[model samples]
Target: MTRKIWVFDTTLRDGEQVPGAKLNLYEKLEVAQQLKKLQVDIIEAGFPASSAGDFDAVKEIATKVGNTSDLMITALARAVKSDIDAVYNSVKYAEKPLIHIVLGTSDIHVEKKFGKSKSQILNIGVEAVKYAKTLLPDVQYSTEDASRSEFEYLWATIEAVVKAGATMINVPDTVGFAEPEEFGERIFKLNDRLKNLNDKVLLSVHCHNDLGMATANTLAAIKNGADKVECTINGIGERAGNAALEEVVMAINTRSSIYNVHTNIKTKEIMNTSRLVSSLMGLDVQVNKAITGENAFAHSSGIHQDGLLKSRDAYEIISPVEVGLDDMELVLTARSGRHAVKNALEKLGFHQITNSQFEGIFEAFLELADAKKEVYNHDLYVIVENYYAKQDVHNENMTYYSDHFYELMDLQVISNINFPSASVKMKRGDQILKSSAVGSGPIDALYSAITEISELDIKLIEYNISSVSRGKEALGKVKIQVEYRGEKYIAKATETDIMKASALAYINAINSIVVDQLLPVE
Candidate 1:
């Protein structure tokens, strides 16, 4: 039997630290459920010591999602007893709770960040592990900026923490400073050096993408002796971001023979999980990012197209199907009936549809099919989600997909040689708000109209337009980035009308700023 790799996902904790990537309590729960479905071995829920809101959110996830799954849920804390206490209080409800502790041991970190001596820093790290062990058997210890720490000091710190009862030791390329081979050899030597302590101590790696080698470095560490990998969905984190979970998992699975390791990740949930994170977090994954990027499986060049048509292996190593993407050229037109929609949903792996649910899905599908010449798989997912939002079903889908604080009730835009203008009708709870504005273009006009209604100080940062698939009938997608009070927010929408998509996308982003931004902590 091949050795198992523990997939530790920190999308909620570290990934949520990104400015304006906040997920409300409900959104966090939704993400936790999805991660559970993704079959990650561990979930770092949050840094409970940071804020009262974080503490409550972590406790809620442990009590709700953690109780149902075999997932080992945890929260991060500093070496201080207060921080550890907050973590313990939040994670105590989990069946398998873990406490993650971190203290920088590098000369620069010790001197500059902590203003402490090397011995003092080492003592802090060890004490944290010791105290965390008393609370939970599953304790993880990370050396902040481990790549930059002195090798001897780092090794000594690791041995001390392991002796202090840390079941997992994470060596983080905190600033993404380590090159792949160097990082790999570091893990190898450390694992070799710590062998005498006990075989139960698991070595782990957490590599950031500052140098664009996070995935490479993580894979290299796994190739050496690391037993666990820490990552986030869509590679979202501070600065350049952390290693992407999809990329690391696919790399290991594709070259399993090279590493001779296996992970419990449900390979099929990769695409959906990536999309869910991207949508809720409002951070679009770069189109060219590896694994879950929009262009990961796309072939555009003539030579590449010919090669792909001749033999899929010529240019592709991972099929779209393996990652929950349906590449089948299936299309549904306005004439397609209920039976056809049902079959299409089944083909897309969406099963267990009740009669009422099918009725709703089919109705939404017909509406979309009428707007476009043909509706594809991506369109179906959106249709079903939109239907979920409209329904009063009181189910998970309804709660997860419902409007934030604003919903687009109606929109109209006109762009002519004279000028561009737009009108918007939206709802905020029981209020019907209508506004209109003129801009240089249709999207600008829509955003201007929305800004007028929102009456919020927002600066437009970036606007991107994409398609669900190729061809003229493809669904138009618009993703907009805006800044309010120095925090960045992004939102996207898809529709047959680019103008409508633009309107809804901007409205969605503003809604996030209103709802998530104004949410009272605690």
Candidate 2:
């Protein structure tokens, strides 16, 4: 049987440190629920000793709904009584609580940072772990700079903490200096030298990605018998960041044959969880990011497209579907072949194109492809509409505004009455006009002004407002559809202020007439 590797996600503790990535208590709880669904073996909730807010967040998470029985919920602490006490208080309500106490072990760290001798440092590590064990049986002791610590001192610190009842010993690559092979060999040598190491506690690895090798180093450490890998989602952390939980988990699962390890992660939830975190944190993953990027599965070019069509394995090492992504795309460009066009149409549910129809549309698409540089889905829709037009079939149906006027009889109405001060002008058929009047709100005033100036009298048929995205900073989106000159025009605009949104929406509608030629009834 393959041994189960513990997946320790420190997203709450370390990922929260990313600049501008702060999550309030509710957001943190939402993320914590996602981590739980990911089936991580442990969650380092936060450093409760950091501040009162941190303590409250940790404490609330410990007591909140869905604090499961088997999962080891944890909080980080310094190897000091006050810090340990803060962690203990926060996690006191949890069924299985882990107190993670960390202290520096390297001589340089001791001398420069702590001004303590080697023996004093060892005593502090032992005393802290022993004391924490009394409060909670599951105590994890970490050597902050274990990768750079002198071998003898590291071994001594490990032995001391183990004897002090530490359940797990974490060796961190604090500055991410160790190479993969060297770091793995270090764990192997420690296991060899300290024969009682496995007898007393499990070995864990905490790596940073300063050298962009954090995941590799972590896997190597696991190969050398480390039982737990500490990481964060999306590689978020201080400075260069930490190993990404998604990357590490996928690597372990995808290469299980080579590594002979497994983690209890719900692989399918990877993409959804990444998106949720990205949205809540307000960090947009780059289009080319691995695993969850928009372009991760997108393929272009004639050669690759042909090869991918033959067999996905020809160009893809891992199936996009394996990472909860859809099949690769074959976009039509000037270089695209007939196979690409047919395939794109088939995907869009447009099957069985006649020879003449295909030729006509293909020729027109090429012309459009030349003009636009790349034919998009919307362009394809236009081509299809034109084809249907020759068949005398209705490609689209129009609605009369008077038909739906009764639906607005008793609906809730909130109008913008406080119109901002502005100069208004409108024109039609060589008429320059100007007028202003306050109505129920700015939107009403703007409409009155536009009517006076343009003299292209139209009735306000429909208006709606929505948000481009969620949050206080979200852009308010406004859409207006109005009838004039026996035609209807739709216009849209997004802005932070409602008044600006109203003005922009009106302008967008008017531009649809003046600029895009979707003129309304005069």
Candidate 3:
């Protein structure tokens, strides 16, 4: 039997609490809508009593996104009356309103953070849950740093809150200190203890990634009978961040034989959601981050690529299509072997090639791979093109063109004047596109001309420049981050002309969108 794991997304709450990852009301609402599309069980909008801005954002999400969808709306509160009241007022209009009351039960938090005794914390948590239960049927109480708290004290707090009508009992490894085994034991014991009190109450675990074991600990708890997971998108939260929702959900899904549980998350929406949160929050998801990372399903090693070509299961445990990718990426890099190179060629429609021809191409590939970190398709194309030219084979199929949606053919910019203007010539397949625009600045004007020609809803969020080498004539390197339909794409270009470098960098990002990364609009 597959048990359904409840996914409570706190991206708008704990995730936004990161030092500089805060989002405006519009952005929060955008995330809530995306979360709803992702089919998370609950959305913790924000800590309402934290500020007027948060209160308004939570209220708006509850009334608009929450009430319109089947998802539950919730917010965090200390085990204080005023905090619980603020949460209630904000999410009152939600169809399924949940108030999350967190309090410290560990001796460290009780003595140092709150300066209160165990009994005082217990009373405050019980009173808060009791009040929240009066307003909504769903109320969760978290034992802050429960892993470090005395078992007896933690049990007593659990018994008290269950008695006070907390529908969900959350045990958080608040500081991410607990190992998987230790965390799982706590959840198992709590489940057993709660069976005698109120088995109907849910058992939830929230883990942090301080020791880089949050996903491991979370899976361990689920194995020991935790019914709910408190997580955030892209794992954005305090300090080292919370257990990533995508990692946890996909773990349960991919390794169902071990955990025998499933989540409501539509895994197909995982990529879009991760990109949306990363873009709006102005945080970049690490390329190697699990699940939604750039290289999660990308294979680069020679042995791995060979096995992957033979069978996906030889190296990949999960299919890229399962998480909404069209196919697993076989990255051509220095480590990639000849087998991957041949497959790359076949994928580019060079399927009918002589074995000797392929061998000739392979040698050239190795030389280029040694000189570069990764070989793009264009680089591979040139290798093949040069191979044919050396062989004196007039191959009509051999062309310098690619499947790029937009290629910068030419660029002309005029700046240091009242009206900073630029004209761009681009190629999309066989068609030529020419556009000109004036902006408040030179880079802005170049981007405007590109945007006008591409007709994409591309937003330039991050722009940076640096020098590849020293001196006045040093190669100016431009790096840019752009958002397309909520997903972020990064591109870099180096040129002696700073303005041309900026244009090429921006076009590289746009071409990335047009090539393979244009996520479908939900």
Candidate 4:
């Protein structure tokens, strides 16, 4: 029988520790829902004792998702009674609540970070586990930097925690300092020496990517004896990152013949889950990342292309469809032919194209091919989607006056060595409004001008800009969140010019505010 490996997702706890990668309450809820869809066995929500906001997030997740799903919901806590209490309070409503208590056990961490000796660390770990068991039956204990701890001491600590009622023992390569072979050996030795280890408790591994070997080390541990893998989506976490949930799951799936292990993850949801995490976290996966990157299924070279065309097994190990890629992307470049473009469009859900539409799209594709080194699926989708959106707007007569809307008329800005000033004209309903204001920067001045004309007291909370396509003249997309009368609204707009995109995005947000007011109160 194949061993069942549990996936413990710490995207909300460890993954959020990445500097400046904070997710608000709603964002956390969204990620939790996706994690459920990913079918992770455990979701470590957050450290409830850290902040009221974190506490609320954990509580809400525990109530909303935990009660509804079969998966266990957990929260992290230091090996302190107060922290354990907070964890219990936050997740008491969960269907299967777990409190993960950790302590520093390595010589450096115990001596320098906590000024506690090995005996003190063991005592703390035992006390915390015993206390946590009083509140929740399922308790997990981790000796921080377990990879660097002395072997005998680590074993003693584990033995103590298990005796204190810890159901799971996590060995973290806290600083990502372990090689694959060494890490595997450690887990194997622990499994060998620990009395009734597998029967009494599950052995888990949480490896970081500081040495860029998180996935390798994790696989090695699983090969040896680990029954659980703690990881974050897209490998996001402190410093380098934790093992990526996607990489590990896909690794086990692709090489199941060798590993002979299976996880509970819904493999088809992998790509969508990866995208959601990246979007909410504002982090981009590297192009060459193992499974969920942009170029993961992209074919470039002619020889490789020929082999792929003949048989995917010639060069590809994992089918794109297996990881929810749906279709493999053979990039459309100058070297690509009509067959490739036709196949690409068909895969993009643009089948049944008329001769005229095909001709137009092909012409546009040729132009894009000349301009860009490679035309991506997104570029193709944008081209096709924009064409349809424009056609719909024309056919439906979807003018701004049809609703509570604002349209940008004209914008002018002057930015010299001094403070920047902007002038703007906008059409609101049947009225034309104009205003001028000076600000610290051109974008700031433009927003100030718009605010003055609209006369709505709104605070800009967040603004992000990115290019929709590749090139000097690529379309710029702007997304902004604004607070109006204690309510928040998000709006997005795209334009060839970035400044225009910014202005349009702000106006769109203001329009949403107006529309919200007209809606009947629930």
Q: All candidates' TM-scores? A: 0.68, 0.73, 0.85, 0.72
TM-score for candidate 2, residues paired by index:
0.73
Best by lDDT: 3
* Per-candidate local distance difference test: 0.83, 0.76, 0.87, 0.85
* Winner by TM-score: 3
* Evaluation by lDDT, superior candidate among 1 and 3: 3
Model 2 residue runs over 4 Å out of place are: 326-338, 354-376, 385-522
Candidate 1 Cα misplacement greater than 4 A, ranges = 328-411, 414-522
lDDT of 2 by residue, 141-166 (tens): 98999999998899989988888899
Candidate 1: give the clashing pairs. Answer: none
Let me know the TM-score candidate 1 reaches against the reference structure.
0.68
On a 0 to 100 scale, what is the lDDT of residue 399 in model 1?
Answer: 29
Model 4 stretches with alpha carbons more than 4 Å out: 195-198, 335-370, 375-522
* Worst 10-residue lDDT window, candidate 2: 403-412
Write model 1 residue lDDT over 1-522, tens digit each, in one string.
998999999999989989999988888989998999899999999999889989999999999888855698998998899999999999999888889888887888999999989999889888888888888888889999999989999999999889889999999999999999999999999988876677888899999999899999999999899999999999999899999999999988899889899999998999879888888888888988888886788654445554555577888898889888876222367766565567666654557668998898888877876675555454565576677667754454232323336678998999886789989999865789999988888778888988988899999877877777777778888878789998777666788788888887777677667655533354
Candidate 3 structure quality by residue, lDDT tens digits, 1-522: 588899999999999989899999999999999999999999999999999999999999999988754789999999888899999999998988889999999999999999988899899888888888888888999999998999999999999999989999999999999999888988898888897788799999999999999999999999998999999999989999999999998888888898988988999999889988987887878778998887898889999999999988998888888887778888788899888999887756677679999988998898888765557655565677778878997776666444445678999998977999999999876889999999999889999999999888899977867676888789877778899897877777778889888987888787666644422233
RMSD values for the candidates in order, in angstroms, are 14.3, 10.1, 4.9, 9.3
What is the per-residue lDDT of model 4 for residues 77-191, given as tens digits with 9 covering 90 to 100? 9988889999999999889999999887789998999897788878988989988998988999988999999989999999888988999999999999999999999999887
